[model samples]
Target: MRTTHAHPIAAALAGLALLATLSGCAGSTAARSDAAAGGPAAPVPAAAGAAAADEKAASTSEGTAYAAPGASERQLARTAKLTLVIPDPAKAAKELRGVAEGLGGYLLNENVVTEQKDGYYVEPSTVTVAVPGTKLDDALDALSKIGEVRNRNVGSVDVTTDMVDLEARIASLRASIARVQGLMDKAGTITEIAQVEKELTSRQSELESMLSKQKALAGRVAMAPVTVTLRPPSVVIQDPNPLWQGLTAGWAGLLQSLRMLLTIAGALLPFVVLGVLIWLPIRVWRRRRRPNAPGLLASVLAPATVDAEDVPAAKPLDAPRDRPTTVDG
Candidate 1:
């Protein structure tokens, strides 16, 4: 026998072929076993292909979810309250509306009151507008230009963590949806199918709800809201009817006078009491300190006494009585 040596390339090819055969056999056996066990009997390759498709869809949704975060690194929502005093309210209101519209913002709320004070109506004092976050500063400047800004408050809320968490949740939900869909596909019995479908439906609803929340959050982050308040100048009301006005004014003045009097009395009452308490003790102490000083209370309440040195001497009536008595004896 001529020594027959196998070529290395041929040996490698044979090994690969044998391995493929064994893999196919094992795959077939596994499929049959799964079918007997009332599970998915699809070939492993087909299942892998489906799984690949699901992952691709999941990845697509993940990309969509992250798009907002990439655009909103700052993720700061801003709001402001403004108090302005304008000369002409109607003109000022119109100007404010125009400014909001020019900034590509819309008035979320606009209210006008027809009630007039003096001769003119007070334009709406409250105006709520929503503008792009980038345009907020410009909008505020334009609004300030319209009139003198009495009060201006600017506030910001950082939502970076919230937005980031929302994206992560969305990605997780997409993955869960993919898993449920895979379960739905593998379900063979009607009961299994119904159960899987129910779960899938519930998950899908939650996912959609989360999507809506994400959309709203993203919108708020992108657009900033600035409120421009147009305050009309102060006006005094001049009623045409003066008779009733005079009567009411007189009554009001009387009541005001009484109130002021009562307020003064109330304020002075405590001090008066305190002074009386203090003066009583001081008077007592002063009288006790002075030797000759009689108490005012003693002079008013006690009877006066006379001393023996001040008594008058008996008159000669006593001597005459003594002489008459001796003669009679």
Candidate 2:
């Protein structure tokens, strides 16, 4: 009986050892297969694997967000001002309008001013046009062909940052509005609904304003404004004689002096007339108060002359002295 019991216990121990060996072999085979397939040689922990995946995803997103924009992605608003000297400004202005229309542009404004210059009517035109940004150069070239370019100025403003900021704000506002809408749907009380509605209205209004700004900015970026000033060729006075020029200049100076003198005289005439009116009345009153007094004209002339009867006779110096000495004796 003791031998049978010992034999059964030994068989049970051998079976347990064989099962352990099989499980170890299975694990080793799995590891080898994973390695052969370019996977981890050892089993990774689930938490560690998940953390690494999250880190990689975050890095990718960050890189994407901060990547530098290419040249085509840049937003620029361009404007140009040109002053052209042409033979006929009115004709040039009309031609410029056609050119603008041909190049996918429209005339924004046009003003024609007719003025008399040097005894001739001169028509100067100012035209403002909006053209596609891509065609700005072409439009300028066309303008150059129309007349002599006296002045040309081209300017650009980079608006990429502004555009990006607008887009981000719009996205944020939309998300916020969506969240508010979800809250509205779930709101249970009247007060909650009212508050949610108010917030929604405010956000919607803000969104509309933002959208309007975006539209304006985008329009500026897409279209380039060009201002063209068309002026007739300057009139050249071609008098070859220096003497004539001097005489003309002297005559002009004389006329200008006369005009200045007239202006000054005109300005002083009123005050002079007022002073005369006041002084005449005062002088008349003083004369009327003292009628016996010498006339003012006579009083003023009295000091300048002497009457013949009032003058004393002069005696000869030698004769007069001898007579006085005899009489005293």
Best by lDDT: 2
Q: Which ten residues in a row have the lowest lDDT in candidate 2?
A: 34-43
**What is each predicted model's overall lDDT from 0 to 1?**
0.65, 0.68
Candidate 2 on 1-329: residue-level lDDT in tens? Answer: 44433433333223322322332334344233322322222233345334434543453353334332333598888999999987766788899999999999999999976676775546678999999998999999998899999999999999877656555455444544544454454455555566668776876797688667667777888899999998877777775798988999999999999999999999999999999999999999998999967777688777667888899887758654454445555
Runs of candidate 1 exceeding 4 Å displacement: 1-67, 70-72, 120-124, 235-329
Report the lDDT tens digits of candidate 1 across residue range 1-329: 11222232223223322332333233344233333322232222356346635764665565564355743577887888888887666677788788889989887876655577666664656677888788888889898998988999889998877766655555544544554565555555555566657766865787688678778887887778777777776676576678988998999999999999999999999999999999999988987899665566678879978998899886656443444445555
- In model 2, pairs of residues that clash are none
Count of clashes, each model: 0, 0
TM-score, cand. 1 vs. native: 0.55
Could you estimate the TM-score for every candidate?
Answer: 0.55, 0.53
**CA-only RMSD, every prediction:** 18.8, 20.3
Model 1 clash tally, residue pairs: 0
